[model samples]
Target: MTQTVSIADLMSLSGVTFGTSGARGLVSAMTDRICFAYTCGFLQHLENIGQFAPGSHVAIAGDLRPSSSRIMAACAAAIHHKGGHVDFCGFVPSPAVAAYGFARGIASLMVTGSHIPDDRNGIKFNRNDGEVLKSDELGIRAQNITLPDLFDDEDMLGEPTPLGPLIDVATAYVARYVDAFGTEALRGLRLGIYEHSAVGRDILVRLVEQLGGEAYRLGRSETFIPVDTEAVRPEDQALARQWTSELNLDAILSTDGDSDRPLLADESGTWIRGDILGILCARALGIKAVATPVSCNSAAELSGLFDTVSRTRIGSPFVIEAMNNLINAGQVTVCGYEANGGFLLGAEVRLENTRLSALPTRDAVLPILAALVDARRQDVSLSMLQRQLPARYTFSERLQNYPTAQSRALIAHLEAGSEAEILARLTATFGGIAGEVDGIDLTDGLRIHFAGGDIIHLRPSGNAPELRCYTESDTSERSVANNAKALEVVRDLVIG
Candidate 1:
């Protein structure tokens, strides 16, 4: 028996929704059938767009989460059902599988939850050329798929078949760096790799060793540890410092769950902000034009590093869209980055007979490598190299479990209110921390600019039920203080 299912309806029923990247939800809600149906819709939509065909190959990969393999199996089953070939690129970084798929002009899926906890998971979809943009997501949501009777009544598939033959992408992924920067890119540097169950742990080690750096592996965990680059846990912060000082390392590197977002700490073991890392990486590559989320540190513009700075909504799809515009506007060198330190190169960088091809997706490896190379070239420590940038600093934190509806209602309440009413509400909450609102931006969320140059921006988390708060100030101390103060006020506004 076959049943017609609307993807949009399934999204509501399953509680899995598309976020800044892909469809994410609690693992318990992502039954085998749910994942299968979602994949079918994804494939069918791609087929309609001519990015997929009956006999086309679909690359699949995943992170180290305990539930990821099961999700990948369900996704593979959908590919087989759709009369497509499955190229299982098992247990790799999100970018690795996408790169393989792009090289072959095939679509791909990555089973991951990124920086979220292991109890949650997600599927990141990619078209042949690159990530599935917002329009592609809309097409997928509009799919009315006919799901075959392949599961039990509870929407669970029994005993998934094995995903055959693993495809190795390690060599090519590492080669992408070595070919451009040479095998001795990090020669004479002792780098520490904090491998906390990220799927790309071993691959990162291989990359370091291949680049002629002495790689020190630390904190290799079997249990799933969700290391969010945006919010480095306090324990992880202490651990970085301990390892760097105890081992006398030049720098330390790590990535989030699927390894798209990078975490880099300086010699003193203080983690570098992602946007700060982006500035250094762009400088290393001599990027001319750049696109970044508005939540990123304003120093990206204040530093005067790039010729053009395009600030978009806080998502890679938006950044990619802006990056495309930069390219179309005839900017010779182009790139983009997120507040999470995931760097995206929009154009191939050719410098002095060395060419590095562009992979316009969030990539952890490029920033790690670029920062290392830049620091080495300048004969300065990563911390010293950072000091050269402008002083603007940014910080972000979130109140988890805040209902999405309430978050939207809070923002909408203020936006719909008159100027004085909005100011009264804002000042009632944040008046002590910052003065009256000087400006407001409703681009993606509620961004309030204070008369004192402080900023407080609030938006609902894309994937999870969380209310995110971002703050910016001229000094790091003020930035951190503002973030803490803002979150406290936001909590009261949304919950109180």
Candidate 2:
């Protein structure tokens, strides 16, 4: 008799754990059996919740990572074995598959690690309504799922079996924009797309052309590139400047591997922080209420633009939950965004004769297109539009491979003392730049406000093994300088 394996068993044996957005683990640790078990477990949980039925369809997609296809095939097989049909969305953006699934009122799964290194991969699950929240993850973990040992061998699933997408998700996603904003919405803009293996690369270029913009395609890589929007690499910054100067583009747009987190650069090739981009996009759409994570720049409040601003932990599901709460409270025109520049529309919106349906998941194209169209309509440069907001600037960086326990310990040490005591300790460790502690917030992490009007937030990354630091200041230069100094101080503290 073949023995059955439970989801918890697989998770324990393979060390695959749920992160900020999904179940992520190293590719080597995520064997075909593990992926299959997880997928089956997710489906079982959905069925229990009345979200899945026999012969129901599940949309699936993946990124450009080398292992994505193999893992995706395993997921497909699991769905097939569970009596569900598959709508293979192919290599599309995470939002593309999600939007398609939600429209058809079916569950979906995406195989990608987002901005993480190619060695790691993840599976993001979505319900027919929206993204699976923390509660859903808990339920999925509690599910009693079983799979046979036939999926244990790695060699059995070494090669990818290409699956055709049932629907043209790319076209539908593009139409969601062009129809709302019109084909000539960006007519005078010259945009450059840094297409470095993002699944949405070609789609983004085509969208720009369809919107009557002059599209200059740049940086098409056959290999996967882990482009973290929150922690923009120094080399990518230089490349943006080079591309902008050489092409004389009005703006440059790109996204992380899965195309959920956006990267937007001004005409000068200076990349704008994701939080600031979120603020601009919200204001562009005339959003009255907003939900964002605590790590975001406080300019959303400082600008006095939105009627309500709710801050949650550093994750989309948290933000989405908060947004839903606002909606339930009778506040319409609700939206949410992450510091990674992914925007979510919490309600249906109509612009002129076009109506855009709600997509309450992280989306790169919406924010990128909205910001560009807003700038064009205002007849101002993207930089000028940014300047119109409150002068608060923020910078973020991560200490790679830092242990989460160590990060928590350091924060706990400071948080245990009084304000003056904590200030003394911070000044001693971080040098005089720490100044005096004006206030401290432990909402999602340790966020410190200094008398000198600078803010430093330290938190362990929820998705990867790293310690992330965010700094805000009255000026852009100071924010950048303080960010670098804070990371250096933390590195020295950990090493020394």
Candidate 3:
């Protein structure tokens, strides 16, 4: 019999902990043993919950990060040791692996750090049904998992070579959209794909071509690139403009490292905010109910496009849970998305004989494809379709290496006193441009609403040591300016 181990002890030794997205930590901190232990713990939890059985198949995939392969191998070893077989999905998007595995009622895992820097990495676990929720995390942590050191002298792991890919998950994912939307869904649309280092870069291009659109692959990189859809780099913005003029493209599309959160630009190279993209996607699919995180823009509520809108904390699992609740309440057409443009379909719907199955997880492809298709059907530019929404814009940025504890301290200080006192304290840094503090929402973070409809929300990134600030205004310029101002103030506060 295998020696039993404490899951909490392994986490403490590895310094890896659960975040809003997954279990993330520095690469140096995540040794092979740590990864193996965590995998075993996750498996043991699933077994306890009857989600897994001995000799069952567990699919795995990874992103383009250098350390991903090694970590994936360790996870494969863990699966084999736990009496499960590994069906390597190769390098693919997180959603693709999840889609294939969830369809077969099997578990899956993705080794990725998302848009975080190369120094960090993470593992996202998915149950047979969908993403692992907070309760699942607790169950995993509570499992007693033991690991024996195979290499006693050196810090290394047993090499558990993964089996070959069982099937082409990428192709299957592509077929999902092409079959639903038809082969000529995006016919005559010229699109640019910022390949970068996203795992789904090639698949995205293939999908465009399969839909009868022209795809121009740009910015392909051999090295891992951290492309945060939330905080797009200045160079990327400039490149989108240059590409638009040169290619005369209808739009530019891309995603982060794992390709779950999308970055979409209009014909003029203007990047549309992800929440706006979510609204457009829902409208395109004719969804009647939408579930999104509190960090998303209020445009969804103001648009009146959906019969029901539910707001949850900032995470896919929360959105999925909310969407499931709506579905259980007898809503046939339900969907969910994040501010990063990751969409989730919660129900099977038929549109003129095209039936789409529910995919209740963050997916970059669905939103990008939906937005482009919607624009084509309307015979309008992507920018024009965006203009139909309410006149609200959002901007976000982050201060890297900022401690989460410090962020909480600052929030506690600001939220400590009465409304008048809080106003005086905040106005000292923000000035009167923010107007008076109308209200404060502490849903997942500290969100402050001003009397003039300007809003500023501050929160620590769940996966990284960073302080994130989000601002919204009636005009795009104001939103952009306020984000910068808020970051500057946050920087000063940290330094002081």
Candidate 4:
């Protein structure tokens, strides 16, 4: 047919739009035609920027979701149609194929919806260097792709050519850690790998044993299980406690689908909050400068470990951008982590005998190993080690199905006037919970500081039509309580 498709029009028509991590949509909406056109637009934009060339190679991988394989095949077909070869690093973590593509100076893609349910899927794109930034996304949206007549009227491909030979990226992924931390990093630790359909399940279990840890595989599942690291599921919470006690384990570890964000629980079976775990991991790595989201707990600055702290919007791209700025400003030993617990190394780190190289993308294994090895070196439980940081507990929850336009309106109402007027309005909004407002920050969201030191932050989700609220207090119970109360207030304000 040789049809010319506008990326923006396709996104709106197919309901598959780009998010913080990738282009995600319902499985029904992500047809072969949409996926193929999206991939073409991505490659075309990269070529325009000189990051991709004709006949270059591209790597592809995916999670264990049933829909991922089909979506990945469409992406591979697009690569071949665009004169690029498919490396086909099948069924690997997002970070693994990204590393391979970066090392080989080629573009890459991962077909996964991250922590979202299996009804949805996504394709995460990366350049030769790192993930596609906001500018790259804009470039892709502005691009026009030529579509072939291979797809049916229903936008489905009829058995596209099979992907190429599988490249073993997991071995190199495992070696990345082993080479940096040695084989005996966790010689005396007992760990649990919760293998609930994560693409890297076997790889994580193998890596744990290879690093000298007694590893147990728990809850292995044939079905795709969506695990969100930020908000631990109630059943998963119970499972971690039971696993720790039954296995006499020191810690339990897992990650979200595609194995990018980390999920770690202490000996008490209590899942460590991702932001808190991030602080401990940064400290263990001797990070001198840190870039984190504004919604993350303020423990990074409170710990007094880093020479500089950069607070950014709630996404990896923003954190990466801030990290690059820190490096450009002459600060070394830089790193970044998300509230979801994915850690990014911004520069090389020199340990006593080994050095860890910079990998700017979010990684699950690095922070998991860092925490385990640091705990061993300190001869303390993960709980005790966490207590060494400042006393702050945070809770986050989101109002699903909330309209993004309404969420923006709420924030705008709170920030609609001069400084004093805004303070007066905020006091009116939050005075029932705590006494007057102490201060407010408009960075990425509406964050309010109360007179009594409690904090409330509200922001719209970048990946979905939802409103998220974060509350921080001196104790975990209070933090959770405050969050519930804040959401109640939000509901009352909006629904009424």
RMSD in order of candidates: 1.3, 1.8, 1.7, 1.4
Candidate 2 lDDT tens digits, 94-164: 99999999999999999999999999999999999999999998887877766654643462454444455
Candidate 1 segments whose C-alpha is farther than 4 A from its true place: 494-496
User: Could you tally the backbone clashes for each prediction?
Assistant: 0, 0, 2, 0
Q: Where in model 2 is the C-alpha error above 4 Å?
A: 153-166, 417-420, 494-496
Predicted candidate 3 versus true structure: per-residue lDDT over 317-383, tens digit per residue:
7998899899889998999998888998888877666888988888999889888988898899999
Give the Å shift of residue 131 in candidate 2: 0.2
Q: What does the lDDT come to for candidate 1?
A: 0.90
Using TM-score as the measure, which candidate wins?
A: 1
Task: Count residue pairs with overlapping backbones in model 4.
Answer: 0
Kindly list the per-residue Cα lDDT of model 1 for residues 1-496, writing each as its tens digit: 9999999999999899899989999999999989999999999999998888889999999999999989999999999999999998999999999999989999999999999999999999999998988999999999998988889977888879578899998779889988888887899999999999988999889999989899999999999998989888999999999999999999998999899999999999999999999999999899989999988888888888888999999899899899999999999899999999999999999855589988999999999999998888789999999899987788888888888998888888777768878877777668789887767888879888889999999999897888888888888888889889888776766433
Q: Estimate each model's TM-score.
A: 0.98, 0.96, 0.97, 0.97
Q: Give the alpha carbon lDDT tens digit for every residue of 58-100 in model 4.
A: 9999999999989999999999999999999989999999999
Report the Cα lDDT for candidate 4: 0.90
Candidate 1 vs candidate 2, TM-score winner: 1
Query: All candidates' lDDT scores?
Result: 0.90, 0.88, 0.89, 0.90
Model 4 poorest 10 in a row by lDDT? 487-496
Task: Kindly state the number of residue pairs that clash in model 1.
Answer: 0
Candidates sorted by lDDT, best first: 1, 4, 3, 2
RMSD of 4: 1.4
Q: Which ten residues in a row have the lowest lDDT in candidate 3?
A: 151-160
